[model samples]
Target: MKFALVLVVIIGVVSLVSTILVANRVEAEYSKSVKRNLTNLTLMYVLLFLVLSVGIVWYIVGVR
Candidate 1:
């Protein structure tokens, strides 16, 4: 349906924009702190992955 198509487009745009923003922020932080502490960086990535995974599942369920 047209509604579903529009929803998909909107979700895709939001995901792309958020991903780029988060990546840029993460890269900046990593560059500054890589030498200071590696554990924090590793934890951040793990948390980010979990958050994204949950978001994807939530979105998929909502769509269905």
Candidate 2:
């Protein structure tokens, strides 16, 4: 359980950093449509991460 939680956190952090870097890079060259897409994609990723993290914590606590 500890390992799984840690792994999830690490993956989430890495994904977030990578996303931010890519978004910044693309923002410079892209127009409004592309920027909007990136923004949507980022929001989805954030929502997914939050859901997964909450589920995992809830499961752990319930198990205990």
Model 2 C-alpha lDDT per residue in residues 1-64, reported as the tens digit of each score? 7888889889888887787677676644575766787788889888998899799879888999
List lDDT for all candidates, in order: 0.62, 0.80
Which residue runs of candidate 2 sit more than 4 Å off their true CA positions?
27-29
lDDT tens per residue, model 1, 1-64: 5577578557756765565465556666575564344545546555765786687678888999
Top-TM-score structure, candidate number: 2
What is the TM-score of each predicted model, taking all chains together? 0.44, 0.72
CA lDDT for candidate 2: 0.80
What are the RMSD figures for all models against the true structure?
7.6, 2.1
**What is the alpha-carbon lDDT for the whole of candidate 1?**
0.62
RMSD of 1: 7.6
| Model 2 pairs whose backbones collide | none
